[model samples]
Target: MTKLIIQIPCYNEEATLGMTLAELPRQIPGIDQVEWLIVNDGSSDRTVEVALANGVDHVVSFARNQGLAHAFMAGLEACLKAGADIIVNTDADNQYCAADIPRLVEPILQGEADIVVGARPIRQIKHFSPIKKLLQGFGSWVVRLASKTNVVDAPSGFRAISREAALRLNVFNEYTYTLETIIQAGRQGMAIKSVPIRTNGYLRPSRLVKSIPSYVKRSLLTILRISMTYKPLRFFAVLGSIPFSMGFLLGVRWLVLFFLENGTRSRAPSLILAAILILIGFQLWMFGLVADLMAVNRKVLEDIQLRLRRAELNSNQKER
Candidate 1:
């Protein structure tokens, strides 16, 4: 009987909140044993009332709209405080089926993985949007390339995380935090797996498409930031190689031309440009090495602090 908590983050989703809450207990037989936490991200509608009316045990409300990432972070902190051993994050819009909870938690229960993401196969659904399909495909590829992890759905909202994994995650911002989490987990060698799930029809048309350009820009920035934070060596090496290689090739070409023209002078502009590019590349590489050392030192400090905290906990338990 492992303790589990189901966390839902809502934003003015009053229309479907009641139905979503009611369906959860019906779909999962052991629902009584699980805690349901609903995070109201400054909903202007009756979302909180609907959740409370539907018998939600825990509710966290924000005075102002803080994006999805903040809502999820709040719900996660509440779940952890409630002594949850496993936490599952789902949507309040009734997009994910509650019946899939068991499947999502299986990997965590078996100690096979730290995080399990529920991936919806958009192709199997009827009336799938081609634009969404393309974005998902592109986003998946970007996540794979950036993290080097075989995650199929980095943007999926439905996910289950063990207590340890949940505590380790510190998402401070919105947009692409999920992708960043996957990247961080991969860097830490945490096991991750995906479970198949299905999404219900949206109550209203999604505004995601309208924000594609902004989303893409933000996602790329987040990926680069994550790379620099956790895998600086790889990040700098990849970026540095481009300019370095270009400069090297240009320099070689200039030298070959100079020699072929009977010891003529090299192209001054080309030589200067090549020198600048090479210098910039060398600086980037050195910065990455320094960043890597700093990251290592920070991790060591964190480990030491964790050990101290554990010892304090043990002492407190003995006194009790």
Candidate 2:
């Protein structure tokens, strides 16, 4: 009976959504049950009546605003159909620090981690802007090099996800699901950790980084479109090895200027521009070997959509 929901994702945040639900923590230890969801992404006001006068068990409504990565996957499908084993996505404007959310779900209740991420210390965050703390430490070092995963807060929306990493998250990115759900839970090999959380002083200013070169060009095109949708053959063989190593150093400098000018008219336009950049880097490494077989058929259709979302939410919780 682990439970623990705690989502947020609001919009039109009815004045900081009732001071961010008056410091949410219905209780937390090993968390028997600590709910509160929000989602209400289309809020015209009253953010779902201030998230049901601040008690907020669940809401998920969205008649329009549909953004923060589809209100964080519709608050992770309403906290996995209301049976949340653990899923804490904080931030309606109370920039974290709901008493550190039990140190961000204590490494997934000490099983070690399935997705923890709270790490917001970007050079002691005082309203950031040292170029937004060097673009959040170079966008968390390019999402720990496109999610090989040492997640030092890849745009942290204060995390914690396990219900088997929320049935293998998908978040196609409408702009932010906090950096495409930490590069889709660090390239899907889950066990992501981070911890060191705590913040809550900047009540406003980020509607998802309104502008810092348009939030580093939409967070580097959502980490290069989720690293070409989860490493399409090492992102097109490291993008076709930069023009296949500049067409193999320009066909070895046109074969050392044609064996020191013993023949060939002026290196035939430098060996036809090094054979058209080595056939455009071997046709971009054969489009990364057909996009790595369509990313292994999209990981076998995401393992049959995580076994049809756990057999359709355990057959609708055994039909109520």
Candidate 3:
């Protein structure tokens, strides 16, 4: 039987939590059983009570506000423990149309994708400012380049992951799980696909992106960090090439000036600076090589970890 669990990571969302939960589908065609799991990230409000009252199958609570990334990871764990074969993650504010859950999980159910992301129509979202929409598009483009994937929506929270895919995901960022998870999925060679989906009318301003500047800053940092982590070679190579190219041109200029004008004293500083830049660039390139090697090692370790988790879960199932 295909067991599907829809998880919502909630904060102080007492007022909207009920509305979000009320619309969630209790049944889907391909899924034999559909369950709800809520992660309460230390909300000082009645988020926990609201979840329980909404008939949540499982609820994970944190002692304090641990942030979205932690809450998402916790929810994944709770879902796995509850014997969820597939996991769907959504926002508690009801930004996404809950009716699209079946569409989001369709790719995973058909074995076409290990993870499916519901891409919202950025231009159509009326609440989004022009700048926000542009930034969103730009961010998605950068993620596509960095992750080497075709995902059009990197920051989308509405997504579905198979049990296998969920086991391999690890969130290191404290800000948000949306971008990092996509990068992680891409780096780990998991099959990820994006489907066009519609969103509901804006209920309220996003709590995550309180301001445009803060959102851009945090989102860019997360993307860059993940890029450096997974694709260190590319990251370092690009950075190193700049200095190396400039140093080469400068050194050539110094050499030509010395040969033509015979000005050794004046060109000494230029030559020295050029050599330093060249060395710096070379060292950076070498650092990248080392980081790339370490990244490979990390991938190997992650594979082992996933295998161990699968074995443990199978053993637990047998005992039960």
Better of 1 and 3 by TM-score: 3
Which residue pairs show collisions in model 1?
none
Worst 10 residues of 3 by lDDT: 261-270
Task: List, residue by residue over 48-120, the lDDT tens digit for candidate 2.
Answer: 9878987898888888887888888878887998889899888888988888998888888988998888988
Please write out the lDDT profile of model 1 over residues 1-320, one tens digit for every residue: 56688899888988888878876752334333687899998999999888888888899999999888788888877887776778999887787888788888888888899999998887665555677678777887888777677888888888999878876776644753688888888877778898898777766654333466777777788878887888888788888888988999988988898889966775899999999988888988998889888989978876785566446545654675
RMSD of 3: 1.3
Off by over 4 Å in 1: 26-32, 207-209, 301-320
Candidates' C-alpha lDDT:
0.80, 0.85, 0.91
Model 3: lDDT equals 0.91
lDDT of 1: 0.80
Pairs that clash in candidate 3: none
Order of all candidates by lDDT, from best down to worst?
A: 3, 2, 1
Over 4 Å off, model 3: none
